[model samples]
Target: MAWNTLTCAALARNASRRLHHRALSTHPNPRPYTFHIGASWAGKPNEPHQRPKVPWPADGLIGSWRDRTLARPNRTTTSKDAGEDFFFIQEMRNQSILEGVSFGVADGVGGWVDSGVDPSLFSQALMYHSHRYSRNAWAGEPEIDPTLDYEEREQIEGWEMTPYECLDLAYGGVLREKFVQAGSSTACIISLNASSGLLRSANLGDSGFLIIRSSAVHYRQRAQTHFFNCPKQLTKLPANSGRRFSRACIDSPSEADVFETKLRDGDIVIAYTDGLSDNVFPSEMVTICSLVARAGGTEEEQVQAIADRIVEYARQCMKNKNRVSPFERDAARQGMFFRGGKPDDVTVVVAIVHETS
Candidate 1:
């Protein structure tokens, strides 16, 4: 051992003194600890959990729209169907009646085709009627009313109706034609009110709409699915079916899940069917949109690119030859038929709602 190093006996004595002190201090005069729960409770009595308020833009929102629909590649050669899906948009300028903009998309349920019914017809008719009704109603058409009872309104063709009423008219037509049992459709519609800067949205089935700001999901519709194959939808109902509206359909105005949110400049709104929603995750959508927002070009061009990218992404997912689909994992969890990305009609609508200069 070096002369400067401590001896072995000295090291053992030092270690023993530290251990003795620690043992002497342990458990001496221990007291019970009390925890108060009231101060820590986030939801206190008489006070609901509050949502952080968002500051809305003062300038109005201007929208740029792009959409695409692609048929499933797996359909048999004998089938001529292009996957029943349809949509329309209305963009209005400086006018009171038709001031803002609106758009909607509908996905036809395939079940009707098996019954010899063409779901495309229903989907197209619904979009057509909705577009027409929204045009006239927003243009300050006198005949449409928010207060009119369903029965009191005329069933005639010339009458103007509110957006919800227009949906009812479409439903009644389906019933009168006895196409209710043949098939049904899911729809998601959004109308931006120029004067108030409020976005009004109506949705059915798994089809949904989402609003993104700064590439973050600000708002989204709830997907209504009873099970994997069964989703809430607008379907055939009795004429006198006093049932009116359900969460999925509007018959007599029972009720509608109308989503209202204030949109600011640079916010993006996307409405899509299960083809895209089920296959692609929201985080992926945000990533694509973020790139679109930063890509060099005019805002219009960027917006168009965003829509194209979204549709292309969904299409690629459908045709992905390798890799297990995220959708399959979901289906398995839900006890759905095991498979890959659902091969069905794909529809996507993207609107860049921003401030008008």
Candidate 2:
């Protein structure tokens, strides 16, 4: 397939300019803010052309989570083409004035052999269901203690209800009815309660969630991926009965695994599809967050800027392949997944958490 240099250039340009604006926005009122969330996506050319159909509901102080989807070159000769990978962020309301949660999910390209199911449907189902579950979980729970240390309090509150169980219920019922008959997907979720200064997160597949606190980076994996199979833990689940259990058996150990952390005044929690994490390094992520923090902008703006830089960095990495080391190949492959002659889709969602004095 002939490479479309023009299209690649346009993609890179649009992403970079987006970062510039996000990085430069002025800080909004920091009064014990409720929450801020942002989401972005890119589609692979080989997959079916399904546009993201999730709704962006505006709540309290949380800004509207914006959406972006881009198309890439096709990989196969068949009339059924694959598109770019999709990435998205959904920032849900902090159940109480004291807590907030944000998450991002990415679906792998379904065109590849053994990719299992169509990623579009898988990603959509996971995001839609997970968000609904979080909302319900928050509603059923009692008010969180404002006096406890943020992280400690979260552990206490998180235990009362299981986000993973909520996820399981969502997945087992409607989500399964609609998509599981075909296949399953990898999913990760992250939540933060500001007043309590606690963070809760969870994952079920390769899609990852990370938290950057005071220059330290923490990585969380939702589900493990084998060369051609699902994680062992998942396959053993009782739900594995004759199902396409490739990725679903490895049940997330409770949302706590994905939801651990205490927020300082300037912590950044990022939930993203593999497209961004696959391409960018942990150190690079820290650098992007630090730049945003130092530059000074609203949490939403800083997140957008960081995400934009990540896309630009991926494009640059593609152009400078000769400089990449063999040891770095594994890391570089993440970024390359979205580039090259036949690139996969790429998507990222960034959320910055700030403490209100």
Candidate 3:
């Protein structure tokens, strides 16, 4: 497949500019913010309803989070086929019990750009709906039964709706009439119930999330791919005209693996797309998280630094073609041979738990 060279040296330069220009806030309840790399939607924003902005700190043990994403190095944002990645974080209302914070990352498959549909829309739409469903599902849940034990509580807390249900809802948003081109994307979502100390996650593709404690990996989502360059995804149905589509199109929600874990104070959770995960190895990720965990600064500053450093590392991997990816290293460890890194959109979210056990 041929790839276009981006004019954005303009793009690359702009990314550098944004990173330096980011404002720093030291106040306890610094404002919450969101950002994206690659192309923005052409029409009205495909985002889920926007909520009123309020003074909120990006960190706290109960829930503090920050995120960032960047196009593959040397890629131009103006290209239709440039990084097609999107992410979101939904903050809970003051007294919500069922859902405290929700976050997600999605990678829009590049193949769909030829079909006249901007693949970013597919990803952004999925994340928008997933964000909405996460909150609504929690709001609609039955009141917790105080009689339940810890095991029962953990199970029941995440049982209101399956991950697949959230995927389907995101799919519906993608297929809405305003958007006509058929497309597909991979998504991973994580939601936290601060009061119960439960962190629930689900994913439908290579995009994944992880939990880190004491400079070690507490948990990391496994990548689900049919093979290289072919991640499992939620796809669009063909129109009645019976047009042909890629054989990879299964046209259904991919199975979403779910994980639930209890977070303790100072644990760091990270979610990222394949650009970072596929290029950097697990041990490398641990080192990056550990540095952030130990970094001296406000929690918000450290989290931002973590996102910046990881994306920078992924960019370095892309530029140094001879660098063997973690994937290749694993294959070599297993007595098979593989090599090199992948150049693609990289997105990451860093969240720090504030409450002590």
Candidate 4:
């Protein structure tokens, strides 16, 4: 049951059918507000690197915020060969200042192959198309007609597509042509409108997003691995679908799923690629975030500290394997193994919400 043997046609058929059903559901329009965003990226050991910068809105915020990415990393590496391919983009409506959205993405390296497609491309595509898609969806654009079903258009309720759908269409086309090697990614995006205060989110693969309130944590997870012969149900693309068309598909490519929630004052939203999650625990993440908020520094400094703690903690744990406290060792063995075992590409984006009086 190697990843090379999975069938892409069957997987695609299933995914497309699932998406057809999801599109039929009703989605709530969201309220919106202005907010600040900051992001950062650190490539895996010995690989190319790119850093995410603060994106500023094109126009003044009436009910929205914006930010843009800086540039790709200048330094290159060849060791473990794990580098981060990440992207982020923010946009505001052309006519309306009260409506806007933001998207963030990080592509995971395909197993051993270079997966011809750069990770940065995927993130950039998500950021670019998501804004476009959100604009269209909010404006009531028609979904891609799978079969040009004119009959259904009259009798059936059209599905409200998410930004992820636009991303899939755009990204899928690019990967089909450019990326010859097998690869996968975990992505998450958030769209908000100040007029309605509605927040929409979508995810795929393993990248994660977290909402932090005063005392609680709400996490949204996407993209589960389709390991060799594993039976867990995660979205996996069918085999032989991408450029190579020879490698087996593991997990079905996840759907362009969406979730809506309300935003309140004093809320903190954190989005990150697997590089950060794989090496750090959820509780530990919360602790680091709380400390950063209290200590009060630039977003970049806070982000660097969080990334450093993960790398340093993992490195230290690897060094003191035998000295683990009896109680802690057992838990560490089961849970922290991935974090301490090796260094992986790490990227984190932190946004702190301020209540406008």
Candidate 5:
């Protein structure tokens, strides 16, 4: 603040932001590849208002990006679960089958509860706006359907949106939400350009994704944190409560870790929150998914099976006092003696990459 400092990180971010807002290719194909995606989530048993157990979502639970329901607020569940953690899954289409996919997960900071804010207000609203923000994005040049109303066209000024901008826009959306007065959350979101096979991501905090290829981890995000237990998180604080929530870590989507990679057919991407990460290991994830890989079916069926198994594994481990979990191991590393699993909300999103012939 003293010198209006311009550090190397600042310069890098500025350059990346420009690349992110650049116009998409003039000629866009409606379908270059189609992905089969599915999701599974649950509230920790100790959490209040949670059902005895959350059954897996229906097999045909797929959705369209154009499906207006995605843009709506998540009233579908009570505040307890998502006030803990939340997730979204949607497929993008133009006129044909599958054009691309946009999906992510968010974990609300439980610390907000002490400040009288329903944690879901921030995480859920952030996600609602995140899902809404592709609509919540930068103006570009191309892709507005001629049939759209003048206002609709204006909202989506036709161009590709980078994950960084989406997170930035979504964060702003939360700030404007009068209802979300104050709170914080960790988010990990992805934009898969099916046509070009490019996958771009923005992850802040510990919630993140991993790519599995040929039964092994092709890619995985290392959890970003300020110290042993406090991960990087996006937050908005109430002025009156600033002294109270002073220790809360505040992050902007700009500080998010941006990653890009070329995805190959059959690669499986599992994006999840720390609930799963803290409970399971990468080698364990490969082993769990291998069950469905051996008993294969259509991508839709396999995707559902994979999501179910992963969630179930985490749930079971959470309740098994004798079983040492990843979070427990990490606790030991930090010289804290905690046992078994760390019970928290769990969310898992699975996608299978498929290239059309």
Candidate 6:
């Protein structure tokens, strides 16, 4: 993979033209802000949602969290008990130095189970490699650039990597991992620069993030898909696998849609897998955020509550077949009929931004 998009010199040139700065940079910031992150998750069947003991803070650039104790199906995606979604929230760094934060959600393609592949394996590995790459900006092991294309002295830690670049490197990492076998996943990634107040994002499929401000949904990315219920995804095929898998909505991280926006104080960023969107409407999320934004402890605590409410509400919506859901609405638009909410692995990451005191 040509990760040249984030080379040191190239990034420096781009930085000169952008409004945001890496939080770890020594440059003077005219306006400083901090980000507080919170997240929630639940597998299929709408069990009680779970979250980290506490929300993540603006303290460091390398803090990361993953869920392992939750019970999920061991194999087939058709299993009602399966949870094929995965997610991560980690501070992005440049050579161990705090720069920004990167977070994302990945939903494994359940159909892979038909080919004897575990659906969770691909989604989990994708998040793992992406988090590792964002934490240190190196694909594989600690300091070594697994690509081994460049000389040691000039290896790139990605001075200010873009969301797509991060996805690209992580995609490379998955290819390097020999045990992955075969699978595919839809991903949406975000990079927030605190000092510059800029949000850079890359989305490859149904999983996406939304920007909520002033008690309303401000900006939302439309999902990319080949057709109704078939989202764009990145896949790794086995050596023997042929064109049979090629017809799937296979995509490359390079093709991810990218966007940039300047953030403001008290903005809410919600990133989630399709499960949330499929069940809960955008208007509903804005109402949830507005109601929960206040009556909070600290910044992170507030967002955590918001995250919890959104996921729990989505689960509730899933169990109700009486009302029309986002998924059903979308299917109707495509001339396909569907019932209530979709039941799949749900993962969410929420962030609240505040100006420095």
**TM values, all candidates:** 0.65, 0.61, 0.68, 0.59, 0.77, 0.78
Q: By TM-score, is 2 or 5 better?
A: 5
Query: lDDT tens digits, residues 141-253, model 5?
Result: 23436696433543653334667767777788777766567878999988776667678889999999999999999999889899877889889888577477767788878
lDDT of 4 by residue, 185-223 (tens): 556766554444456666666666777777468655544
- The best candidate in terms of lDDT: 6
**For each candidate, what is the lDDT?**
0.53, 0.46, 0.58, 0.45, 0.68, 0.70
The ten-residue window of minimal lDDT in model 6 covers 12-21
Which residues of candidate 1, in runs, are more than 4 Å off?
Answer: 1-82, 92-98, 139-166, 173-181, 237-256, 321-326, 336-339
lDDT of 3 at 330: 59
Tens-place lDDT digits, model 1, residues 1-357: 121112222222222101000011133322121100000000111223121122112241111111111221211122222346667665432323334565677777766554455566556556655665555444123364547654444432334433455565555655555323344787777766554456777777777888888878988888776667666777753346353324334223224456777777777788887777777788778887776555444444455455556665666666664635657877778776555565566666667654442
> How much RMSD separates candidate 1 from the native structure?
24.4
Provide the global lDDT of candidate 1 against the true structure: 0.53
lDDT of 6 by residue, 28-49 (tens): 5433766777766778873432
Order the candidate numbers by lDDT, best to worst.
Answer: 6, 5, 3, 1, 2, 4
lDDT of 3 by residue, 1-357 (tens): 111123212222333322111112453443232211111211111222221133113353111321122232222223322246777666443333323566778888877755556676567667766665554554123354659642354344233544555566667766773443556888887766545557777787889988888888888888887766578888775576364663755645647787787777777778888777877777776776565445455554455556656666675675565888876775677687766865667777767666622
Candidate 3 overall Cα lDDT vs. reference? 0.58
Cα lDDT for residue 250, model 3?
60
Q: After superposing candidate 3, which stretches have Cα over 4 Å from the reference?
A: 1-82, 94-99, 135-164, 241-243, 327-339
- Which stretches of candidate 2 lie above 4 Å from their native place? 1-34, 45-99, 108-117, 139-162, 218-223, 227-259, 315-320, 323-342
> What TM-score would you give candidate 1 relative to the actual structure?
0.65
| Model 6: how far residue 13 lies from native, Å | 46
